[model samples]
Target: MKKHLILLLLWAVVGVSARAQKPATVTIPKNKYGLQVVSSTALYQQLVEQNPDQELVELATYIPGLVLDIKYATPDNLVKEPVYTMATAYARKPVADALKKIQEELKPLGLGLKIYDGYRPYHVTELFFKKVKKKAYVANPKNGSRHNRGCAMDLTLITLKDGKELEMPTPYDATVKQSHPDYPHVSEQVKKNRALLINTMQRHGFTVFHNEWWHYDFNEWPKYPLMDIRFEDLKAMKN
Candidate 1:
């Protein structure tokens, strides 16, 4: 009888320890197309803790003199409505570190970086698809965007002294052929500026999105999973 009682106590302790060791399960509802997203803040925090390299590092914090002109935070974007609640930009640690180096290189030339968007939540991409209805410009919700994984950035070059943006192929989110990096009709000055931006970003481990001159994706974007955690939740996690 004493042996049986001891076995029961040991079993109970083992069960408790097993439960405690289990990682928190993040439960984001699968989309209509059966795509899973990481929506739980706790799960996101757990991920950052487990893999510090994949943590979504704030860009403004790491890149000195970086300017943020988040168009989606205002009603200036294609949707003509504010989609993001905050004007913050985030990227994976390695991507952010690469941008830091890019910023240093640009500083000597009297130029800086102005960010339009980064690390968008998965739900925002879904909404963009619904509103646009154009498969070419918007990311299909079935496969989330690189931005959802914190590996994509929409940015342009800016003059450091005046904080004015350099002339680019086209405005942000413009669905036009001129936005293409290879478009040949732009003036010499525009071409030069666009080339400078793209070459600099490329030298720092980023590749410009074929459709958008200002959009760039980190080489490791495919390694991260789709995340739906909101900026407010991320801010709270930092605090």
Candidate 2:
């Protein structure tokens, strides 16, 4: 009887300890738009483990001949601060897979994809809103950016030989009217380059944002949660 009692005691202790180790779920209060953000790494991991398709995957590992120039990791961005701790890009499984296809398509044409940003954390969006204080260029935290959902990408076309970026209507993250997809003031070559990019992405299940030539949303964006997991945490999980 004493042995059985000891086992029960041990079991109770173990159970309690396990429960304590589990990270508490982060409660994200809905913004005015009724969007619930996923701000906890634990919750994001649980969702991914439960449904592998929901995983935020590293782009370099998934795609070949892909160049990543994550601007948020540098001070060149509008925020004027390194918003991301690392210069890496991530996207959902389907988004990455689609990019891979796009890369393959561009290879024969001596062009490839150069990523500017992907999979932005929710907190970063809040920071951008606070800094920019305008909805014209920055996404309102009330409605988390598609990047927070790991379903958007900011990229430009680059030559495969010299890796030179093609001339677009405007630079990445430019907030000018020239950045508009239908802006008619651009030179013919710039127009051609922009058309090629928009057409290629559209053929591969991506829709270009009207204002940002570099930004594209994966058609399945609505299915994913707005994630705030950091790049370091995501890298640690892969290991």
Local distance difference test scores for all models: 0.89, 0.89
Q: Which residue pairs collide in model 2, if any?
A: none
List candidate 2 segments past 4 Å from native.
1-34
For TM-score, the strongest prediction is 1
As for candidate 1, its clashing pairs are none
What does candidate 2's lDDT look like per residue over 45-107, in tens digits?
Answer: 777766788899999988998999988999999888899989999999999999999999999
Residue 168 in model 2: lDDT = 95
lDDT of 1 by residue, 1-239 (tens): 99999999999999999999986754546767787677888777777776788688889888999999999999999899999889899998998999899999999999999999989998999899999855788898898999999999999999999999999878899998888889999999999999999999998889988889999999888777789889888888889
What's model 2's lDDT at 158? 99
Model 2 worst lDDT run, 10 consecutive residues: 23-32
